[model samples]
Target: MNRPAPVELCHKNMRFLITHNPTDSTLNSFIEVLKRYGVTTVVRVCDSTYDKAPLEKDGITVVDWPFDDGAPPPNKLVDDWLTLLKKKFQEDPGCCVAVHCVAGLGRAPVLVALALIESGMKYEDAIQLIRQKRRGAINSKQLTYLEKYRSKQRLRFKDPHTHKNKCCIM
Candidate 1:
């Protein structure tokens, strides 16, 4: 089965490339394309068994955060994961970080959405923007988490009596 190619998520300011896991046939091409995009680092959010040694040898820094598909990492891991991406962006302003899971639709976009939220974008807008870039970017379960996260934020700051309607319904 032929999989679709990678999609570049953002271009106006900070850049991120989102794509599915590369197979043996697509590995070399993936590296070349990422280089063309000025991607100096890769965040591998697929299973640990998916080898990325080739990418590492190509001089692109790759960080692994393996987990099953259709699920987000633990809350603590999510925090640490975002921290690592933040540091990478700080180290090189021009860097394009490529993030991927098996299909780049579910898990990869969740991370991208969270990063955008951290970068000061509203969760709704961030998800919309990502969806524009790559259709079906986040699955329903992932969207639920984003909504839950947003609701938690509102709960932490807003008065329940005044903002109960604005908080998460769940």
Candidate 2:
């Protein structure tokens, strides 16, 4: 099934593009579009066995973080993932990150919201922004989790080589 073009989310110093699963035909085109928008990184938050595999060529890096439908990742997991993303962002400020799930609905939104919240956006505001960009991004359960979610101690990832600690968004 042919999917719609990826939607451009917040774009400025950093660009975020979100989309549904792309069919074989749409994958290349989508990559090209992402390239046009300076997207050098992609995070596939879908299940394994999706058609296309990630590539690290042409100045793009794709990584997979799969989860079952409607299952939001745990806070630590989110923190770890966001830490990796932040490291990538910090490495190349001009790079854009594209995140997607099966339908760009439940899981994708949750990940995006967490990323934004970590980046200092209010929970309610993050939901609103995602909903405006793509309707049906989060359902009630996810919303509830967001509402009640709080971290006692922030998780950070340090580069083993450089020993530099990288913090996730807030």
Candidate 3:
């Protein structure tokens, strides 16, 4: 079977691989493709649940943040997603995060765009970037959300030795 490959969106130290959900038959191939991109985490935003055991067995972390189809994620979920990205990058600079929501067009791309915006790219630029790479990405509602999104303050991290807090800007 010919499986569609994931689209990669990389900006500086942040990298995201967005694709459709894998089925029982495609899971192995999906994992291979993810490995090629050095993906360390998989974020599933769709309502459908899959067996994460295979992905986890390959040493990839799986995060579930499900929401209704065709709707923007809750603010708290967005915040948490960003936080996870920040921490993941801090721990492994070269690792990539794989995101998917059924078709890899809507929610997955929205989250990636938000991350790009937080990483200092303008919202328009972010949307354009994702659409360029992963055709038919954000929908009208998601695009509106991206247009109005104001990035939250950068998460603070403490220096282990100095015991001082510092903002780790993406």
**lDDT for each residue of candidate 2 in 95-136, tens digit (9 for 90 to 100):** 667888888888877877777776666789989998987877
Alpha carbon lDDT at 68, candidate 1: 72
Compare the candidates by TM-score and give the number of the best one: 3
Write candidate 1's Cα lDDT for 86-111 as tens digits: 57665665468898888888888898
Q: How much does candidate 2 score in TM-score?
A: 0.77
Model 3 agreement with the true structure over 1-170: per-residue lDDT tens digits: 44346888888777899998888777888889989999979999996546889999999888999887778889899989989988998787647999998988898889888888887788889988998888778889988888888976443333446846667779
State in Å the error of residue 117, model 2.
0.9
**Counted clashes in each candidate structure:** 0, 1, 0
- TM-score, predicted candidate 1 vs. hidden true structure: 0.81
Query: Model 2 clash pairs?
Result: 118-169
Number of the top lDDT candidate: 3
User: Model 1 misses residue 77 by how many Å?
Assistant: 2.2
- Candidate 1: stretches off by over 4 Å: 11-13, 48-50, 150-170
